[model samples]
Target: MKPLIVKLGGSVITNKRRRFTVKRATLTRLARELSVAKGPLVIVHGGGSFGHPVASKYGIAEGYKSKDQLMGLSLTHRAMERLNSYVIEALQKASLPAIAVQPSACAVVSGGRIQSMELTPIQKMLALGLIPVLYGDAVPDLSKGMSILSGDQLVVQLARELGGKRVILGVDVDGVYTVNPKTNKNAELIQEISLSNWPSVEKRLTGVVEGRDVTGGIANKMRELLALAERGVEAEIVNAAKPNILKRAILGEVGLGTRVVAR
Candidate 1:
């Protein structure tokens, strides 16, 4: 069976308003929910408060320009690892065989896009019934010295390369909305988005989002997921902050969140 790819959005897993603060209770609950999955799984997570704040502080996303940025790159990678540790610990406590796969260690990019990655380990791990966890990180780039690899982009690459069945993005919002849902009470939820109607939907999407997300935020996520849709892979953006929602979404329940389709 193909593995299901689940991305734990930064805002859902961490307190984006605070630095290095992991929402332990929420993460544990989500991990427990993930433990119910009966098949292979791959978890990709966002940087949120941990990595995003630090990355933005030193302009890590713009790539290496000065010798000072080398330290920024190092700090950024360390922060992501720290966040990944929390995720790995939570999944382990929930009895899910999860292992952290550092993107920086195995991936090289050019212009903030994946160029090559060592996937044999992840493939073998999946074959052994272990869930491989990955996240957005700063990685070496051919065009630039280093770049930020967003979890959204990683989901697209992994699903396509590993032939994932479906991708579920566990986000703070209930689903995609006409505007920034957090700030706009009038924003309407967009339950279904497809390639044909995406242009229209795109016009209504506001880039205004919470946190210091250096990785292009929700708009970039939509673009990335749409690319996956173009290849016939479907994805969902669900309110992972809600109880049982992530579990249900992983179990194939529909109508709980926004669904992005190829058509």
Candidate 2:
């Protein structure tokens, strides 16, 4: 069976408002939920408080411009690694054979877009019944010295390359909203997003929420997932902050979140 690509959004896994804070209880619970999965899985995670701040401070996403940014690149990659370690620990505590796959060491990008990535290790890990955990990290860019690779973009790449049939995005919200639900009382949940209605939905999405996300936030996520949808890989954005939702979403339960489809 093709592996399912699961993304643990930075906002859901960590306290994005605070720097470097991991929601331990939430992480542990989610790990336990993931342990119930019975098929091949590739887990990708966002940087949240861990990586975004450091990268933003150095303008790392704008690409390499000076020697001054060298430290930021190192620091950004280190921050992501630190976060990845926490995820690895949680997965292992749940008795899942999870291994960290450093995207910085394996991926190369051009203009902040993935040009190529080493996938053999991930492929082998699945064959061995192991889950490969990847995260957003600083990577070498052909045009710029380096750039930030978002987990959203990584999900699309992995799903396309690995022949994944489904992608589950675990975010803090219930799903895509007509507006930023956190700040708007009138915002309604969008149950489904398709190519035909995407143009209209795109207009309703607000800019990045009050956070240091350099990955273009929800707007970027929608764009990337839409591209994947065009390729026939269905994706769902669900509220992972709530208990059991992520587990059900991963288990193929529908209607709990906004479904993004080609049609």
Best by lDDT: 1
Q: Residue 175 error for model 1, in Å?
A: 0.8
lDDT of 1 by residue, 54-108 (tens): 8888888898888988899899999999999999999999988899999999988
**Tens digit per residue, CA lDDT, model 2, 1-263:** 78999999898888987899999999999999998788899999999899999999999999888898999999989999999999999999999999999988888789999999989989999999999999999887999878988888889999999999799989888888877778789888989988999999888877333233788767667777888999989999899999999999988898788999989
Error of 1 at 112 (Å): 0.3
Model 2 TM-score?
0.96
Candidate 2's C-alpha runs over 4 A off are: 207-212
TM-scores vs. true structure, each candidate: 0.97, 0.96
Candidate 1: stretches off by over 4 Å: 207-212
Backbone clashes in model 2: 0
lDDT of 1 at 211: 41
Please report, as a residue range, the 10-residue window in candidate 1 with the lowest summed lDDT.
205-214
